[model samples]
Each structure stands twice: as structure tokens, then as C-alpha cells.
Target: MSSPDPAARPGHAPPLRVLILEDSRFDAELLTETLDRTYAAIETTIVQDEQAFVQALAHDRFDVILSDFELPGFSGGQALELARKAVPSVPFIFVSGVIGEDNAVELLKRGATDYVSKGRLARLPLVLERALKEAADRRTLGIAEHRLRDAHAAADRIESRRMALIELSDHIRDMDDPAAMAYMAAQMLGRQLGVDRAGYGVVDTVAETIVIERDWNAPGVHSLAGVMRFRDYGSYIEDLKHGVTVAFADAREDPRTHATAAALEAIRARAVVNMPMTEQGGLVGLLYLNHGEVRPWPSDELEFVRDVGDRLRSAIARREAQIALTAFAASLERQVEARAAELEAAKEQLRQSQKLEAVGQLTGGLAHDFNNLLAAISGSLELMRRRGPLARPGDLERYIGVAQGATQRAAALTHRLLAFSRRQTLEPRHLDLNELIHGMEDLIRRTVGPEITLDVHAAPGLWSAHVDAGQFENSLLNLCINARDAMPGGGRLVIETANLSLDAQAARAADLSPGAYVSICVRDSGVGMSEEVAQRAFDPFFTTKPLGMGTGLGLSMIYGFAKQSGGRVGIRSKVGEGTTVTIELPRSEMPAEAQATQPQGLEPAPRAPAGETVLVVDDEAALRMLIVEVMQELGYATLEAGNGAEALRWLHSGRQIDLLITDVGLPGGMNGRQVADAARTGRPQLKVLFITGYAESVVLGQGSFDRDMHVMTKPFEMHALARRVKDLIDGP
Candidate 1:
């Protein structure tokens, strides 16, 4: 096909530079000769591998590209993408025997100019003719559009400064109200700049929020007023906070605003200038000019905006100061009226007797309800006090047991209160839901009792979660018990665990993060809660259970635990239908650990290696003394420190310390985790145990610990602490 169109199409077309990407030598010659038939003069460059093709694209210029759709070590679409990114004005045509119509259509959609199969080499010339002409046409149109934009920008810049200076000279100084001043400034700027929307928003720097109060809008443009976070628009808010004027020609083209391009376009702010107004070196106001269409923003236009924004801010500040003085005078008038109102209030004192009758009625009902708890405690103690003198050992034991049960109930009430308030400590660790449910199933069935049938569904590939295991079990037990009460006559109860994933939209709807999660759903077939009851189910002290039966803090405490663990819980129910309670915990990204099983009971604390010394740090002296004594009893040499400073002192003393056990909360500005990290820098093999009452969420949330470091929540049994320390040091 090569070398013969010289006389056939003589002097009809200009010199066309074509880049061909094909592996077969014969096919490349055939394609080049075919293109030669269409044009009078042509120059062609051929390359096969990606490296040669990329180098050619970088160093050479070409008018058109011809590529094989299916090539060795390359792809037609990949070539098209590279061509579009590098020299987008060039026409990219695919000419290959293996090209399918569907594949050709997809390549066309992705910016390939056209495709021709080798079986139809005669048609390749015509395809090249159309592609080259279209590319030339696009170039012509782009030049015209760019020239128009420049002309418009020039006109806008010339008129911007003179008109803005005229408007800002005096008009704003006459306004008395801040709102009026804000509207006047907006209108003057909007008309002079010919923008879609111009507005003045009061800034609350401490809150990082702005309230527009009002704005001047062009015809058909919607108003944007009310409170909004500065970050909702773009990261340019950071620049504004630093007293910088931010102007961008296009939201999608500017790096500072591109990430929020869709949001800006939605609000008709494709081009914008946000000017900051400062008072005493702190930002307190903003003047914004926005446009629905993308356009160039000149430096002179931005400077004009800054000048007007300052004048508007000064006028508003003066009005606000005058208003504050007026308000002070008005407050004196209010105080005089308050004194007269007090005299009138004295007349109402005689009506107190009448009001007391109604108050007594309400108090009586509350007292009657409170007596239920008081009776249980008082009756148990009264029996103990009266029978103490002549009681046998067995009788005394029974009476004391009764009194202890009453007080235990009271303690449970307080514990639930702390849990709901998120004041109770939690120790979260990586755990698998399937394994956790397998161990807790039997207990769940027993709690629901014989009448109810329990069903457990564990998804085969349930994800691992980070949560407090004991709190999770307690929450599950509470739900199961609540389900049992709902189904007094017995029904089906289902417990399920499954992996969950949420995208941006779904996560926003669920009020959760967009990522992998583990969900536990407890469903029951019984008389269900009404919408009214379900709404208040998580409210503390609001329960459907009769007095003295349920504390109502159960669900609230579960809610608190879910939130504190960076998870969320939701309940769904309808009258006469079943209820489903769902808890979604974020999947742990920490490296997988062996599935943790329920402890079968405590083993003897493993003794440390010979001559191993333990460094104990705590702010509480009594607790520190107790721990040191325990370590000594466990047959380990112990060194003690009352705070983190003293602990670090011992750590840096070149003394031999086999293990470090410190409280998470410590004085002298060094927490237990920080001390461990610092010590490990010098002694990498130092084993650590963090004892804490508060969650120390920020410290542990890092999820950086190795097998040598462990944590134990406060109020843990001394045996548990001893075992943890021994495990870290001895590595069992």
C-alpha cells in the first residue's frame, strides 16, 4: 500500500505528521502507505512498546496518531489516554485488523478520533481525512473562545476600579443598622461588579462559622443566608483566616477549591472572591462576591474588592458601637421596670398557698414512686438490726445476705449511671465478632429463658472490630433480656453478626464513617415497642417496665458505649411487629491477632525471671504502695515512683529494669504511654503495662502497640494486673 499517491492526489493536502503505534512491521508499513493515499505529502513515525511511544510523545510533535487497537505490550485506549493528556489537539485513530465495533466505540468515547479494521484498509484513508479536518476545526474554535475571554476580562478590569471607588466613597457611612449597612454594601458591589451574588456575612472566628444575614442577588439567583462552616466551601477558608484575600478564576481549576468544586457549582459559585475583614488583628467579618459562570479574575479587580470590603467593615463597626451604647441605656430602663415588676411579684406571694396545694399533689406522687426502692433497702436492714442479738450463725448469714443484696442493687444503679454518662472506663482491643458471639451464645439463651427460642446467625466472613469485650457482652445480655420480657408467652429471637461497608452517601445517612464495619443485629419476634416508646428508649430513666423492674439506663448505657467506641447503634420497631436493634462498630485496621476466647478462670500469676526488677509508677500513693507490695509478694524485686518524672528518672539511671508498669494518667506532663515510648527509644526491649481509669482514648487509639506492650483498665483485679505484667515480661 506504500509509495503511490504522489500523482493520484497531487498537491491536494498539506504535510501531515502521523505517529503510529503497532508491533507488526508489515502492518505499520501498510497503514502508513494507506494514509499516503489520502494526503499528497505525509511523514510517519512508528513505535511499538510503551517506553518508545512515551518518549516520542514527549520529544516530538505530531498532527495525528494511528494505532493498532490490539498491540503487543500496549493498548489502544492507553495510547489514546496518553495522547489526550500530552497533545490533546492531535487526532488519534485506531487502525487494526483485530478491532471490534464495541471496542472501537468505547475508544471513541475515551477520545480516540476513530477506528478502521484492516479488512477495510480502503476506508482508512477516508477516516484519516475526517479526523484531521475535525482536529483542525477544534483548534480554530479554541483560539476564538480564548480571545473572547481575554477581551471580556480586559473590559471588566478597566471599569472595576473606578466604579468600586465611586460606590465606596460615601454611601455606606449613612447607614445606622449593621444589617442595613451589610445590604447596602452588597447591592453596591453586586451592581458595580455585575456578579450573580454579593454578600456580607458576619464571621464568628472562634466557631469558624459565618452567617450571611442577607445578600443582594441578581435576577433568578437564590439567596444564601444563615449559618455555615467556612470549610464547607473549600480549604481557602484557612487562607481567609490568616487575613488573606482569596480569588479564584474557576472552582474546578483552582487547587485550593477543586476538592469542593461540586459544592461550589451547586451554590452557583464557580468563580469567587472572598475578602476578609479584620478587627484588632482578628477576623470578624467577610465580604463575598460570587459568579455562576467561570471567568478570569484580574489582580486589579481583587484589589478593588479589598478596598471596598475594608470600608464596608469600618462602617458596620461604627454602627455596631452606636447600637451597643443604645443597648446599654435601654438596659437601665429595663432595670427600673424590673424593680416595679418585683413589687407586683410580692402580690403573688399570697397565691403561694393556693399553688402549694398543686405542688403537694405532684410531690406526693413522686414520693410514692420513690418509696419502692427505699422499702427494699430499709426492710432488709431493719430485719438485720432487730435479729442481731439472738441470731444463730445461719440466721445471721441469711439476714446479712439480704442486706447485701439490697446494697448491691443500689451499687448496680450507680454503675449503670456511670456507664450511661461515659465516665466508666473501657479497654478496647481487636476482636472478631463471630468468635465473640460463639462464646456468648449459651449465656444469651440462658438469660432469655426456656420459653423463647434463640437463633444465632454468624456470617462466614465477619470482619474484626475494635471494642470493649465486656461492655459488648453486657449490652447483648441486656437486649436479650429486654426481648424476653417483650415475648412473655415466648417467640423467636435472632442474633446476627455480619460484615458491613458504607460508601459516602450511605455513611452520611447512617451517621457513620465511610469504611468497613462489623454489625451486630438483635431481632425479636414479639410485641414490639411503639414509635413513641422507641423514641425515648435510649433516654435515661424512661422505661416501659413497671416500677422496681428496670432501671431504663440499660439502653442509654449501651448507646454511650457504642458512641465512645467510634461506633453507632439504632433501633427499629413497630407496634405488633418485631424489633431489630443494630450496633455497627468500625473495623480495626490493626494487624490480625488470634481470636480471643473467654477466660476460663484465673491461672496462678507466672513468676518473673530471676533478678528481674519491676518499675511501678502511679500518682496515687496508696495504689502505688499496694502494687509494689503485690510485685514483691509475687517474688520480683520492685522499684517505686510516685509520678512519671520519678519513673523516667529511674528508667534513665542505667539501672536494670525488666518491666515497666505505669498508670495511663500521670503528673509532670508525661503519661504512661509517652514514658514507655521515650524509654523504648533507649531500651527497645522494655516491656510496658498501662493501667488507667479513663479511656486514654487518644493514646491507645493510635493502635501502635506490639506484643510487648499491653493495657489494663482500672478497678481490675490485682491478679489480672499481675498476670498481664508477667505475660509481657515473660512472653507466654
Candidate 2:
């Protein structure tokens, strides 16, 4: 068999060279002829021995190595090992005559590409072709591996630049000062790009200049923090104005940088990059990076610098906006404070106006009421004076009664005013709310008239309340009358009593101590009030009635009574919805006491004890003498004093006194209570009667008194005084 020829081919054909280690000239010739005929072109080299084989391999390149398994000087295994040492990528195949199966397998195992028997020379060509194809595939794979490694290196560079840009962005966001942010951005960009210096410049179009606002330079490098005219770097500025980045490995060689070449050389800058920063379609500034040595700025590095410029621009804008917002907020706060002061002044003026209006209303009401009373008293006194001594006993008594009635009415009016003011003396007692409401059912029905329906709902487990029974009855009656007036067409009135427990939170809102309370609700289906009217419903003389219709003291008196009794009053009303007034009084744990029982039938006034002496102490001489005369007519001996000091002297004089009638308000820094307290040291059993016109001292004392003491308001009847005196002298 002949060896294949190894030669070069035309038209994109790969070159092939064969190394032949065969002793037989016929076999080598046969292989060469077979390859020359089958392939377009190939080259072949024949080496007869081991020495020739080594020499031929050292001097020439080969695609495949074919050898005889056994030769004159060596075996095919030796040739395979030698070929591996010389050219490890070359394919080595064995072709031999009379070779054993085991030997062929052994040859292939020891680095031989394949083995072909000389008897099967036809298979030699196919085996050789496969070996050569395999060798080509290995070369292609090596080339692919080298390219893969290069791509990985490039990817790593890109990732590093991306990481640096991300870190820069994070740093810029937290910088508040625009100038400081620019300096910091320049420093980071210089460090990241390994440049000698970096800076930012603001563009002045009108001035045709570029001002270096901030800059960062490496050690021993000059800073670029100065202004430069656009004319000095005309070509560079022109390129930047068109939004093109100007970069150069050699500033002296770049035509566009010629105008600024002298300045670049002065700074020892060999390479530079200028990236434009634009805002609102206008060039705002430029970011520059300079190198001491010439550098070809890579595409990736340029991209990173551009991103840094973008971040710097955004940070500057944010800082300016923040500064403006802070200034605006400060100005707004000052304006708010000024407006608040003006509103406060206006509110003060409105309060003064309301106060004057209230005073006028009170004065007008007082004048109207007192004038009528005075007229009645004056007319009665004139009639008596004109009829003097000639008047019939009945007529004389009638005239006197007329004057007395007017006086009593005036006194009642004064008492009501005091009550509404919360200055009246109160006699608090523990009483059941259910019982009080039930007892007043008859009076409430009469007051509301037959046309109105009245409902009394008393809770089963009613709690006792501590309050003045008489005052409560009066307040209830007033409410009923007001309800009747409101409902001219006759609606329903509901009075309910319930036990309530007020917690701390609820009690605070009502201005009361947190504890159990008894609630009394009076609901009326009448003409309801609006929010404004309801707010002022408890103001004295603030009446919604027509002139001469109401005194407007009903709700005011009720409010005062509730407060003085350590309770609270609440009113709920809305126009066209009706009204509900609720009174909550502190609950008493003590058992309720029976109300003072009145005699069913009128009994004759008891006469004073015979020879019983009484002391009369008053600040007014006329009042003292009148009291003395009344006692003397009752057939009792009387002693008189004009003041508490004088009364104490009389008591200390060892006078026998059955009762002491003293005015509560006295002069000389001594009150009736102190005098009475002192007189009691001498006569502990003396019965005391206190009289007052306004009862300021008594009200301050909470109206508390012992069983032997009694209080009477001024303008009382002579008959009432006489009856009280007789009762004090009599046994209880």
C-alpha cells in the first residue's frame, strides 16, 4: 500500500503534511498515491528510521503520523511516543503486515490513533481520514476555549465599573450642599478612573466662559478650580455644545483640543475627557477627567464617567430645591404667627362687646321689675295716708295688706335672683329621687294643665340623692311651667329617675367627682331650641319669650341649684326635635330621711310661754324695736341690742333669756354666729333664730345648722315670726 500525499490545496483548502515511518518503499509509494488521488492537495515526507523520523519531525509540521508497527530499528509504539514528545496534537496511526489482534489493541492504547493491518490496506484510507478529522476538531476547540476566557475577563471589567458607579450614586444622594457634592463627585470619579485630576465646571453662555466650580486632584497635581474663557478652548467647547463627548489619548495631537493644548501642557495633562451635563435641553455644566500620562479611555470607562455626571447634576438640583423649600417654610411660619395674633385681638374685642350687651340686658330687666313693685307700694301707702283714721277697719286692713303684698312680692323676686346666682342658703338632705318625683306628680299635672300629658318613670332600684327638697320641687315646677309655655298646643312631658354610675372620665367632663349618682330627666315634647339658644339657655334674663311674658330665670335657677348641690345639669335640644333636661346629683349611701311633715289642717298659732324673756339683736334699730314689740305683744319679756357685741354683753350680764333673735350680718367685726356661739357658753339651752336679707354668711356656711337653730329670710310676715317664737319656747 502507498502512503498518502500531504500537500497544500487551492480555493479554501486546508494544508496537510504527512510523516511516514515505513521501511518498504512500495508501501510508502502506495500510501502517497492513494492520498494524492483521493484529496485535492496534500504534502508527504518519508523517514525510513527512528533517526530520520525525529529529524523530519523537528524541522517540519505534520497533520498526521503513519508508521509500521514493527520496523528495521524500532516499533510503532516508540514512534508514537516520539511523535507525542515532538508534536502532541499530531495524529499517530499504525499500519503493519501480520500483526496480532492483541498487538493492534496495545498499540492504540499507547497513544496510537488507530491500527490497520497490511492485508486490509483498503481500510487504511478510511481510518487515516477519521484520525485527521479528529485532530482538526481538537485545534478548533482550543481556539474556542481561549476566546471564552477573554470574554470572561471583559465581563469582569464591566461589572467592576458598574459597581463603582452604583457606589458613587449612593454617596451623592446623601450630600445636601451642591458645592460639597460636586467636590466629592469629582474626587470619586478621579479615583475610579485612575486619573490625575477631575472637576466640574459651570457654563456661562452669556459671558462665554466656563467656570471651574469644584475640583479634586491627585498628589503633586495642580487643581483646575478657576475660570476659563470659551474662546481659549473654542473647538473643544463647540464639540461639547453639540452634546458630544470630547476625549483624547494625546491632547497635543487631537485637532479639536489644539486651542487648549497650552493649558493642558501646563497642568501636565497628556489625556483628557470632557462630558457634557445638560438640563432642560440646555448645557448646564461639564465634567472633566485628566491623566498625567496618555491614556486611551476605554468605552466602558467613558460610559461610567457619563453616568457619574448625570448623578452629580441631579444632586445639585435636589439641593437647590431643598434650600428654597426651607426658606419658604420659615416665611410661612412667621405669617401664621402674625395672623394668629390678629385673630386673638379680634376675639378679645368680641368678648368685650358681649359683656357690655349682657350688662345692658340685666339692667333693663331689673328696672322694669322693680318699678312695678315700687308703684304698688307707693299707691297703697298714699291711700292709707289720705284715709287716715276715717278708713273702715276692713278698708284699712285691706290697704295695709296691699302694701304688704307688694313688699312680699319684691322679696320673692330678690330671693329668686339670689337662687339663680347660686348665693342662696341651701338645706341639703338625703332623699329618694323616685319618691320626690312621685310626690310632685299632682303639682306637675296642675301646672302643665289638662291639655298636656305627663309621664313619670321612676326606676325600680332608685338611688337616694343629697339635695334641698324645697329647691328641687321649685326647680321641677319651673321646668313644668316652661314646658307648658313651650307647648301651647299641648304636648307630652316625661319625668324619669334612674340610678347612674359615673366613671372618672365621664365625671371629669361634667366637673364632678367620680362616683354613683341619681339622674332625673325631664323630657318635653314642645318647641325645641336651636344650638345657639340652648348654649345660652342658662344665662340669667336671656329669655326667648315676648316682653312681660317670662322672667327667664327658670333654667338659670335650675343650673345654680344643681351646681350648689354638688350635681350637674345637662340639656339636649334641637330645633323641631323637642328638649330633654337632665339633672345628676351625687348619690348618698345613707338611708333617706322622712321629709318634714306639715300639719294636715291649720292650727291656731301657739302663744309664747308666760314670763319667758327673749333677746333681740339686730344691726338696724327699727328692726330690733319691731321684734321687741312683737315679743312683748305675745306676752313675753324682751331685751334688745343693736349689734352682736351688744347682744354678747346682754348675755354676759346674767340676763335670763328664753330665746335669742339675732341678725346674721352684724358690724364691729362680730357676726351673729360668733355672738351666739359665745352666748351659748353662758346659756347653752338658748333657742336661736337667725334673720338675713341676703344671707351671704349663711350661704358660705353651707346653710348647715343644729336642731335648736333656725334661719328665716327677710321680709317675712309678723305672724310667721310670732308662730316661730312660740314654737321655740314650747317643747319639741
What is residue 401's positional error in candidate 2, in angstroms?
Answer: 3.6
RMSD in Å for model 2: 47.7
Tens-digit lDDT string for candidate 1 (529-587): 89999997887666889877876778988888888778888999988898999999999
Among all candidates shown, the one with the greatest lDDT: 2
The clash numbers for all candidates, in the given order, read: 0, 11
| Model 2 clashing-pair count | 11
Note the Cα lDDT for every prediction shown: 0.81, 0.81
Model 1 TM: 0.45
**What lDDT is obtained when candidate 1 is compared to the true structure?**
0.81
